[model samples]
Target: MLLPGSGSDDRFVRSAFAGPLSAFGITAVTPVPRPGAAVVDGYRAALDAAAAEPGPLVVGGVSLGAHVATAWAVRHCAALGSRLRGVFVALPAWTGPAGAAPAAQAARATAQLVREAGVAGALAQAAAGSPPWLADELGRAWPRYGPGLAPALDAAAVEPAPTADELAGLDVPVGIVALADDPVHPLAVARRWCAALPRAELVISSLAAFGADPELAGRASLLAWLKAGGR
Candidate 1:
């Protein structure tokens, strides 16, 4: 199963992961996001439901979605055992507390803008400061949340990702993809995660490459996972 990032929906997730995973005969399932603070809970519930199925499953996502999936894996790895195959993490924003992280701060700032100016105004403000591709993505995805956008952004800003200790305890293979030039999702953070996880590999790419190919991160992550010994 794959999940979307903060303020993103299933459509972006499908575009990012479905095609790459399909090559391995893996069917990617992306659940619609719940609004506001319910976002994390909703994602966890979806994972629980997917776990009920009888096959090995790989869970992953981007940014906030990556954090949630990793936390879920940490919480359930013991019970699930080998039923949980591995994880595909793309652009992990932070580890441990969200405090002062660029991505967290950005999310908080966006939330405030959404509240003060509304989605359209917030999108315009965000687009003005972002690269063309990122701006276009925000334009397409932000309005989908409607009035719940601010609360959802706030939730993601404050929600803590798994700590280094938590990651160390997770023995499952992990494939991580990091954009070397992405300040919002720092390469240092991805390195931290790769170092902490017992079974993990990191693939470094550039924003230019990712912009040219949306599937670049997904394919790199899955290949990294395989390199880390994930079947």
Candidate 2:
């Protein structure tokens, strides 16, 4: 199973993978947090639930969720043994220094703004220069997206982001995919990921390759890699 980025309901990532994953007979479950709850807690609970059922569970996630999944794999590698396959990391936002990710900061700032002005008011400002599709999607999913997110984003921003030096030492294979035009998930980070790991692929996507691309097949490159890698 793969997880969504911080602030994104699991449905977003799950829907993106459901059709493609079915061809390979992979079943996915995206957990949604109860209102006003923390995403991490819900995620941990989800992971625990997943672990309760199977031996060979493959986990992957985007953004903060990606880090969580990766960390889980690393920590449990000895226990999961060969059952734990590889990881698929898509659009990893900055989890490092102050400037690592502006979107995280923007998200936090926007959250505070929303508390004051509400979703509509916040949507107007968030839509200013960002891609229309991204902004609109965020606005549409606002109700389901924001509650568990504020704390997640805050906690994620301080992650000592995986430096090339750090990633080079990871135990399992990792797949990195990025969007060139997207500021949240930077291409440079993906490049560094591919360069650092023993086995890693950096799939660079374009502006058109994301957003309006209906089939979402291009973005599915990560999913294809996941299935191929035995996920």
Candidate 3:
């Protein structure tokens, strides 16, 4: 499934994944948030909806959605058992323990930005200064869907970030694609997630590469890994 990056809905994936991933015979499934649906519930339901489609089942998403996809699959995989294929997670947001001065500052700034400007202003500001292809991706995505993102942000941010201990329970095979420069989706957090989860592998990479070449960058590797598991 095409689990999208944060605040992005399926449209974000459409721009990023339509051409590159489909070549692998992968049908990315990006689900819209149901009205009044709890953010987490919507993601959980997205996984269910994707799994129900005729074909093989695998779960994946970008950033917060990526985190949600893996967390949900980790919890449910044993029941589905081996039918659960590997996960392809791109820039999974780091909700883990944070003592970094820079990260702490960025987190506060992000929270305040969203609070003051709503999702649009916050995302627009982030895009303007953001280097590489991600700026283009977020710029296109935020304006079209930013107003509706308040609920999703509220749902993910309301709680204290997910603890590493909590993630340890997720043992299903997972392939994590981590970016180097993203303040929110840091390499440190990706390493932590990989270490915490039992059956997980991580590939360190730059944020620019992920956005610029969806086919050649770590994303391609992620898809290859997921497919190799049992496709």
Pairs in steric clash, model 3: 2-29, 3-61
* True-structure lDDT of candidate 1: 0.92
Give the residue spans of candidate 1 off by over 4 A.
none
Q: Identify the superior model by lDDT, candidate 1 or candidate 2.
A: 1
lDDT tens string, model 3, 114-148?
77897667877887887756676666655554445
Point out the worst 10-residue segment of candidate 3 by lDDT.
Answer: 96-105
Which pairs in model 1 have colliding backbones? none
* lDDT (10s digit) by residue, model 1, range 1-231: 898999888888888889988999989899988887788889999999999989898999999999999999999999999899999999999999999999999899889989999999999888898779888888988887888889999999988999999999999999999999999999999999999999999999999998888888789999999999988
Query: Candidate 3 local accuracy as lDDT?
Result: 0.63
lDDT (C-alpha, whole model) for all candidates: 0.92, 0.63, 0.63
Off by over 4 Å in 3: 18-20, 34-37, 53-55, 95-115, 118-124, 159-167, 215-230
RMSD (Å) of each candidate, 1 decimal: 0.9, 3.0, 3.7
Candidate 1 residue 70 C-alpha distance from true site, Å: 0.4
Error of 2 at 17 (Å): 1.3
User: What's the residue-level lDDT of 216 in candidate 3?
Assistant: 39
Superposition-based RMSD of candidate 3 using all C-alpha atoms, in angstroms: 3.7
